[model samples]
Target: MSNDVKRPSGRHHGDLRRVLEEAALELVAEGGPKACTLAEVSRRAGVSVAAPYKHFADRDSLLAALVQKGYAEQRDRYVAAMKRKVEPAEQLAAFARAYVEFAAEQRPMFELTFAAGLDKTKYPELLNAGAELFEVLREPARNLRNTEAGSRDLVLAVAAAAHGLAVFVLEGVLLNVSQAKDLAASSARAIV
Candidate 1:
């Protein structure tokens, strides 16, 4: 059966780009980055295969846009998760949990966001958007009573641990670490 969910069939000429991007997102969500093709996105958006060329050069260009969109969403979630707690350590824990949860929940998008061959020079916006997630962690690390380098090191350590757990969850290799929140909270407690 076709996994393509029914999308808005009627789009204004000006909204085609947005429609195409939404279609591409759905495609990626269902089957990861390689599944997102310009032709498939156009068809899902109820447009001609040629339509996407007006907005995107090729599959990579569209994927780049998707990466930016994914980062922006992750960054927003990180900000909101951090705001729920006043304590720095709590906020850090929240950030870590959110990161891992995002990976598990939006597995395909998360995979594409970190995919190799994503040339940052060509897509600077993606880099800037992704940086926001790190900034949230950095803010909470300031309360750890460390020098600049020490704080940086702490943030990296925490991120590395969280990412490792997230990867394990995504790969389904670890049977014990099933819950993203619990694993993330445990890792956070150990560090903070």
Candidate 2:
């Protein structure tokens, strides 16, 4: 069976780029960047194989755009998860849980965004998106720690612990559900 989902097929000429981007995202979500080809993305998007080149310079550029887009979605998820809690400490736990959930649910994107070894400096938009994503976590940490350095350290520690649990879940050493969530939350507590 094809991993390609049925995307909206009626993109106008001006929005063909969006169609291609959506198709590429589905391809990456299914099987990481290597598995996604411009030809395949065009096919899924109801465009010609040459269509992707019109929007993206090359595959790496498309992957970079995907990374940038993924960070935007990740930041939104973090904010929504953190909003449920009133306390800064609880917000930190929520961040960890949401991080783990994102990893488990979107493992391909998680790896692409973090471990793909892509040179983010070449992609300015991706770097900005990453900075914004980290700021989401740092927002809650700022309330808990007095100094800037301390807040940065606390956020890094929590994120590191959360990332470790997410890797465990992805590797199947831990379940991707509540157990992973509990571990992520508890690890954040321990870090702080």
Candidate 3:
């Protein structure tokens, strides 16, 4: 055999891990969760088939990593989007809007992270990460609830409405972001 093997150079081990994760994410985006195999991700990342194993134990591990990463990213977006000098009500509205925008923009990741049927116990890190995003909402929700018992009901009610609206919008049932934003705002007002 000819000795012409080209090795990956110039990147650290962490970089390789990132590349593997990114490749897996892309595969999931293109072909759903079933298509994201370790061999496929290695080939897509231009590394040897064994390279992925060095970073991920198996396909399931890689998927778990992807789910965890998705949760972290979603949480970061919420934190960044809500860090402004706006009213808590406005922040809540923006939070709902951000959730829909994120789901629409990252459909594959969203599906993998939130879609039913995954075993959360097997991936507690992802579960906690995902819970943290909702936990961030709890503070604002509690504040709104404090306005009145009715206000509390309103807060939960609006959140449920906003979540349903987001799912509808992401699935193409709703067509307009501005309209959704307006509707979410109105729903929030009715809650508080």
Residue pairs clashing in model 2 are none
Per-model root-mean-square deviation over C-alphas: 5.0, 5.1, 3.3
Q: After superposing candidate 2 on the true structure, give the runs of residues whose Cα lies further than 4 Å from its correct spot.
A: 1-15
Best by lDDT: 2
TM-score for each of the candidates: 0.84, 0.84, 0.78
Specify the poorest-scoring 10-residue window by lDDT in model 3: 5-14
Candidate lDDT scores, in order, read 0.79, 0.83, 0.73
Task: Give candidate 1 regions above 4 Å deviation.
Answer: 1-8, 174-178
* Count of steric clashes across candidates, in order: 0, 0, 0
- Report clash pairs, candidate 3: none
Report the C-alpha lDDT of model 3 over 63-149, residue by residue, as the tens digit.
788788788888888777777625677667767766777777887777777652467798788778866876776666666566555
**Model 2 TM-score, all chains together:** 0.84
Instruction: Report lDDT (Cα) of residue 100, candidate 2.
Output: 94
Evaluate residue 61 in candidate 2 and report its C-alpha lDDT on the 0 to 100 scale: 83
As a whole number from 0 to 100, the lDDT of residue 37 in candidate 2 is: 82
Q: List, residue by residue over 1-192, the lDDT tens digit for candidate 1.
A: 576765455653888888888888788777777788887888788888888989899888888887887888888888899899899878878878888888888877788888635788888887787677677678778888467776677788788878888888888865554476777867886887
